[model samples]
Target: MDLTRTKALPIRHGKPKVLKMLLALALLLPAGFGIPAQTSYAAGISKPFPQQVDYPGMIKPSHVTQNAMNKSVSDYYDYWKATYLKHDLSSLPGGYYVKGDITGDPEGFKALGSSEGQGYGMIITVLMAGHDPNAQNIYNGLFKTARAYKSSGNPHLMGWVVADSPKAQGHFGSATDGDLDIAYSLILAHQQWGSDGAVNYLDEARTMINDGIKVSYVTTNNRLNLGDWDAKDALNTRPSDWMLSHFRAFYEVTGDAGWIQVIDNLYSVYDQFTAAYSPTTGLVSDFVVGNPPKPAPEWYLDEFKETNQYYYNASRFPLRVVMDYAFYGDPRGKAAADKITGWIKTKANGSPANIKNGYNLKGTAIGDYATAVFVAPFISAGTADSANQAWINAGWDWMKNKREDYFSDTYNLLNLLFITGNWWVPEGQAEQPIINLALNKPAVSSSIEGSGFEADKAFDGNLMSRWASNEGSDPEWIYVDLGSVQSISGVTLKWEAAYAKQYKIQVSTDSSGTPVQWTDVNSTTDGNGGVDEIDFSPHNARYVRMLGSERGTPYGYSLYEFEVYGTSSP
Candidate 1:
């Protein structure tokens, strides 16, 4: 695959030109000549939706019950799956394409689907394994379809657009965002169901990443070019394509430290752009061009007049940048996320409903009306800071039941998964099975704030409920009984606004023993309030307690959950 190949005409986001000559030639070729056949595989669900993954350093909406969040994702996915996901035997036998809407289509270009939509469909299906029984079959079909419409420049990369015909002529070049998502989704598929199946998803992912993506899309400077047809343009790049989490996964799979360079380069670019262009808001433009990258000129890409503003393309910046923080605990990611959330919190006056559709780099709203495409990503960004808890809870309420077009709806569903903690890293990496032994266990606290703030609420496995100690009290504690002696390796404390400045994890072999001998397993003096996972050498105990010595706030020490993890005593 030649990385420097250029075409006479550049392809816009979803609109592409129809090559009549290629269509004529494609009709003469035999059916499925280049496309691979779909083979049966023993693909089973390993990590399913509502995995309720505990992202190491991320926060979720604490104002709503966990069940409500899970239900919101399922409900939106059902509608999105029905409306956009389409199967067509016109090209590959088992081919599926996500149906696209005709919004903002150029005059000559008819709306079908793009590589972007295919990538979104693939990712959503793979993550939705347990919830959607037919996810595997649909995912296989989507893979086949993406493969059938390979890019003319590089077969490993899917073409950017699939126009009216399902034949090869319908596909035009490639887009960077779609290719990135498609490659990342394959890694996810390999992790969800092992690569022993017919697809060998891991192999395909490596090919796409190494041969296709690295060659055609990634430039010599380590910045992502617009698409395969960009001819390695170094100056101009799409901001939304700066997917830090995806790049991290790429580096993990390929061991290419170049991906790290790419990550560092993009972070630098983000900081530079935010400092220079949006000092206060930290908002970036849709397309950034040149060294010391600045916003693109109006009508620069021939896409739209607002190409330089934070329009549809750049609206996804928050979700893309924040995932690195949520998954990998990157401080840079958190810093970037906090900027967006912080600015938006003030802009919306702390209301999710006031979030506009688009904005300029200086934080002026380009559009007045609210849309899910813009709101959803902001909600995802809000998860980075505990200060935005109320903001994100309001965002979830505003976005959960709303309906929009294909693009907006799909983005909404994806962001919803991220916001609710349903989206997770693939299994081959740091993914681990999470089990909370203290869930629904008998718990007792020294004191409570009121009638609703009971000790059992902390052990009920609900984020919306918590156990609160008496106001301004020190030496307050809460403990949970495991019913029998068990080995405890780690504990997670999801703290509320009234968090403990200092706390100790103490355990006893017997809850009813005389004096109840308690031994300290872990102690922390600088305990910050978000989500803390304290790990230690395994200890056997029937009773575990959180003893607070100091309070972080004026109120009591409140905890949303007290989770214990370990194997049973043997």
Candidate 2:
């Protein structure tokens, strides 16, 4: 990949193009929340846009493609959207489904299949929608349902009902029922949509941590079975590995060291589960129950059932576990993710019979199945540069020109975010064309000369620059130019401010000009200072700037550096 530093655009008061992508959440819809974006603006949506090509001489392919060894990020996004979006949440028959119709219990508390689903799906849809205006509705819907649950004392928080009418009898024990997912939802609301209520929701969720921990940890099995108020035990013993993701989210929102400790401790428990749950054939058992496999490894045959309980073979855990470690920097977590990734690549990829391969990355048949195809994007996005790059090369081959199974508001938007990290989906289209960015040659305008400022040898690139914004010039600013027009998707900023009234960011195509366009992506002004993210649809511009809007501490501006992400050679 290539990255280039282009000049900035001239500042002007001209109105930046008003490009708003709509989300599917009814609550997110403005007063008269309109129909789906796909139906409302298909004609206006652009054909799949391509990343800026570093090598202009590179030939343009006519069809979509994917890597032979790994899943393509864009294809995976399309796959996720095709597999989940557009389904009527109210129609899910409890926790089960046949065809597209609800055939089983109707009163299930499954969050995605009813009015409540508007909230559940909105959580995912809003994030996936990125900077699109459509995300507003999903954000609204998410809060609406979350408020309903919170007002009801969060009965659904305990778990979702698999039947119609909110009965708790049918539920799978996955870590998703924990506070982390809720924390993510809160972050999305406040960070993405700027909902004031989101913080209160986060606080309430923080208070409920003990309850979540109790419900998740107290269970004898590794699985955290889903349920309503009184009905907690519906053992759908499938194996999943999403525990750490919840931990990562907890750490991201709370900055609590205890949470990190808790996450570190789970690795041991995970090891135990892995030993008991993994079959010699390389596939981890999806769900475990009272019955033990006859002639099972003698070590487990006698007491294995007791240990085998916490398993669910779904896309969330196997993939998200890797993502959590990669993002959170847990050494053990990284090792575990490595093992699982290897298993998926070596074992799962060998299955020629399975169309999409089994849910388990290792390809071993654990039996339980689900529609969460977001696995590909998480894996693609989180992978190490070379490895992911190769997979990206191959995955594009598979997704192009393929028909999808589950199409929904949530999954479709998410697909876009995972690959490009930008959330714009040209109207009606499922997949966007590949984007290639110009190779970047990082330049240093100035450097802080000190041994302490030296880059960590372990780090890919040493801390290029660090800033501490304080009272003197409270709102400090940092700017960078990609030097060329490219389809930029996301920006990751780090801050070390102890306290600040507010911090804001602005972006533009002009270098010397004012930021005519700004997005309030996050805050480092108050609370725990850490990394923040701003995601936008792939846009053509070069100049980027981040500055403090308020001074919480006596120090002027507290900034580490700005890390820009895009599809280009570096």
Candidate 3:
């Protein structure tokens, strides 16, 4: 199958007479990106308009597309909290987190505590700040839980596992991946909410990066050690432990040049591994000897029934490496991504069904299930190349009806967060797309009454408050003053038990005041209660409102929070 990749070439946007071709070129370029140049509004005078890309290519995610992606992120987080969060605050301490599957059975319930998940929990918590109002609390709990499992080997590092008194292993060695993300999430949390809060995110992030993660790096080979205890094993490294982008973050936080060496050596060793074991496919082995650069036969022999293949740990390679190419556009990273993605594209024949979950070094399919965890990374890889557009679309189509098991469900959510453009970067970084925030905005309603069920309660940043009508009323509306006319992107509504079965989201400027003339932007007939995030065509509006024509419950028209999201003009 021949793939089509339209290279994004730069052209100046100017007078249409001669530059119509250029403007057309710009539109076809990629992701609805326009070329910025001096528009001659006056004599020899010009102003700058920066071009921003909305989606993966010429296409922008429609309201339905955006809504699905956003909901997937939100819903998955909710599931993570509901399914994985085991602590009953009544019995356990306020900040202590409980990890593992929540089950009532004896054996399963006993295994429902661990230090490993706190890293993942912290990441999911901080990332969902705007959507999850209790993000900080969640992070605080996760941090406390992780701190409780501090390894005796390294006081800063967390123990690999924790369980009920009977199942506790009395182990105190840090796992590399857990600490890596735990530290990384701290950086994100610092940038997201800052160090001043109860967590002191920045200071904590530095300690974890400088003292904990940095200690795991071996000076002998300029690579990551599997754990603090793996000092003797020169080349014993897990490919998944080499978080390419996280090392860059380590450098940023510590200002250490050593981290750069590790980044350089990581690719150098990766190139060596691909050249030796899986040259054609560029498939990374789960375990490898990075310094001398070969598969770790001992680990392969002991751990795997089938050795040195892309299985559980190595499967993360595409998502990790693709991130470097996607964010920084590093050439080596791109070449590595192309190698893996190109191979998958060739084998699958443009159908996601043909792809398997696990593979051998020579590209043999070891596991046949088309699991979401494995497919998600390849879909992310496709976003890096316009050539892989067909499969990217197919991958997304596949995810629409994708099965959701325990592992697949969580990874699928993280993957959705990544591939759908909801994965946030560190704050103040350039090239961040304009986001929609609705916290603390003023909300007014036509039928709202009483302080307990007031209209403004829906915009107070608390998800618990419900704005309810005085009576079971139809055609009741809740509108928010966005303060300025901004580019409206999407709307997220947290509805109470009393929801509107049919509702329309409307927006208008109304240069003059009193009552505003509203234009319907988006409408829904099948409104599911709990939470509904909707997308609309990008339009400018200062006042955004939701009009409910039909009530689902006889009690009233009610909503916990009505959020209007938009981006500022460039």
Per-residue lDDT for 142-163 in model 3, tens only?
A: 7876776676567788766545
Decide which is better by TM-score, 1 or 3.
1
Per-model TM against the reference:
0.68, 0.45, 0.61
- Tens digit per residue, CA lDDT, model 1, 271-294: 888889999998999899888889
- In angstroms, how far off is 422's CA in candidate 3? 1.5
Deviation in angstroms for 400 in model 2? 6.2
lDDT of each: 0.78, 0.36, 0.63
Q: Considering TM-score, where higher is better, how would the candidates rank from best to worst?
A: 1, 3, 2
Instruction: Say which candidate scores most in TM-score.
Output: 1
**Residue pairs whose backbone atoms clash in candidate 1:** none
What is the descending lDDT order?
Answer: 1, 3, 2
Each prediction's total of clashing residue pairs, residues at least 3 apart in sequence or on different chains, is 0, 106, 2
- RMSD, candidate 1, Å: 15.9
Candidate 2 lDDT tens digits, 1-570 = 000000111000110121011111110101221222332322222211222111111111223331211133334444544554442335332122111221123233433333223333545544444324454444444443333333122433423212223333223221333234454555444444333432354454344444554344323333343222312443333234245555544444443323434443344445645565553222344333332221122113222221232121233344445444333344455555556545544543522122232333224443332222433432433243334444444443433333433222233233333343232211111112222121132322122223333222111221212443323454455555566655567665544433335655455665554445654434444634445555666655565555556655555544434555566522
Task: Tell me the TM-score of model 2.
Answer: 0.45
